[model samples]
Target: MKIANQISMKEIAKLCDVSVATVSRVINNNGRFSEETRKKVLDTIEKYQYNTNTVAKALRMKKSNTIGIIVPDISNEFFSTIVHGVESFFFEKGFSTIICNTGKSKEKEKVYLKTLDSKMVDGLICISGQEEIEASLLSRNIPIVTMDRRPKMTNNLAIIESDHSQGGYLATKHLIEKGCKNIIILTKKNRLSPDIDRMEGYKEALTEYGIPFTLQSIVETTDHPKGNFEAAREAIRQELESGRTFDGVFATNDWIALGVVKALSDFGKKVPDDVKVVGFDDITIVKYIETPLTTIRHDVEKLAEVTSKLFYQLLTEKDVLIKQKHIKIPVELIARKTT
Candidate 1:
């Protein structure tokens, strides 16, 4: 076929002696087509190199075959690992992902959610740090799945989270078993379930060991993901300046734990020998720290696997029944030099 101008699907259909819809079906590999007709369309496409506008086609079909992912921070190892897991699964399923980092800002989160909704994404995978967005998400019947922390429980919603309470207990109990008492916790002040649950677990462990829980022992830090490092450093510095004594420290995440270790080092204190430190979320780099951190491990790969599987069932299977909206993955203790 000889072409004088830029070719479109319409021109290809004309050359193939078929309707535009038939050419579209052949192009998208959807619907039924006779073998002979398929050959003709393909031949014409090859000869002219007719280009199809995917955006227009998606608009016409009302499906973009793309999933939007919203995360609090992409720089954090724990959340980034989860994103990697999501991308691996969706890549195998032939779906594209659009990742948005909110940086734990409610305004940015709302904007991203609204934009994703407007873009007509196939589904949403959210590691939501913003609590207010839950009500609006629940109002619509969307195929949305949340990971890590969630705001509220809804019947149709699917949530994937770690066993934070168990992780907290494990981390705290490990410090106590190392013969350290007067333990302090450095955690986020946010209402996110993970932080709160972890604190509760810390308390449970303390109570079990006949150690009294004191409000002064809990230090609240910035809710921003990256801000947590500095928050931990500042909190520990202030506690030390106040002459408050803490033989052990439990950090909600590895970053905060690192901060605690650093601050303690600045004050001429040795880890495990002076003040034992334990962290949650056994991020990869934790093992390489100067003093390898004793931390709690939650499998990000498993979280990604279950989340993608549940979302796929909701997206494809009409009769698929999800009996539970909230699912918790178990956590394990990884003992290292710090504890």
Candidate 2:
């Protein structure tokens, strides 16, 4: 017996010639449905205006068909591109993405995690977080994908990242080939695992070229994004003030490279003529810059595409038995006039 003015899901299913399960799948988006079937069902619902309003109330408790993407900093070009890629991919598959900008804060991250759980988000994608996800989120079998970050514990999770070590090697090696014997490597604020690997590559290049990997050759920055540019500039200025001579600079990102260039110019040094510069993550501006920054290029779109595919695989492939799966996207060096 149905309640007053209540039309059953069975009625709607029969009207559209699809099983109740198909309607449920369409509602939740956890399962697949043909475009034709989806249109038919939606059209029928619109035509009839199922009693008790949209679809059936019983079907509302299932998957939200929404994904939460937690990024450390959305302002960064790298992360913004990543968010765009993931959002575009999921939007086409009947899924909506809820983007949470943590601003690289541990407390904010914790808040987003608990909030997502409260909202019953189907899955989560964490991008470049310094802190690990709370183990409580992992207790449930929630599908997750992270970029260049490994959460504390995991079950069904996928990791995607660029080849940082190789990029660092290529950048440093190119600088060395350009006759830069004394080179300074400017590390990014809040260095992730990939950055650590990049540092290793920098060291490798120095070792191969018989250049000593001394403390003077490395300048480490902290977690303040707003201060990164000024900080890099100050570091270089200090190095110059201390009579420390460096013929080249390898900034972890293009933004930092800008600071390095300005600092060199402040001391009346000519770029490439007196001090060559290279950076990581060849952002769009690198090409048109006055010096045409040489940088390591990473494919953000590919990273997003692969991450979305891996996430869907984790969501659908129940028997695959995934454990700590990691995927690294290759990187290339965009050789410009900076080197």
Q: What tens-digit string does per-residue lDDT give for candidate 1 at 157-260?
A: 68889989999898888888999888999987775778888999999999999999989878887644457678888889988998878899999988899999
Model 2 CA RMSD to the hidden true structure, in angstroms: 8.4
lDDT of 1 at 204: 95
lDDT of the structure predicted as candidate 2: 0.80
Best candidate, lDDT: 1
In the predicted model 2, the residue pairs found to clash are none
lDDT per residue for candidate 2 within 66-173, as digits (tens), equals 789999889888999989988998898888789999988888888898777655577899998764778474324678889978666656677789988888898999
lDDT of each: 0.81, 0.80
Q: Score every model by TM-score.
A: 0.80, 0.80
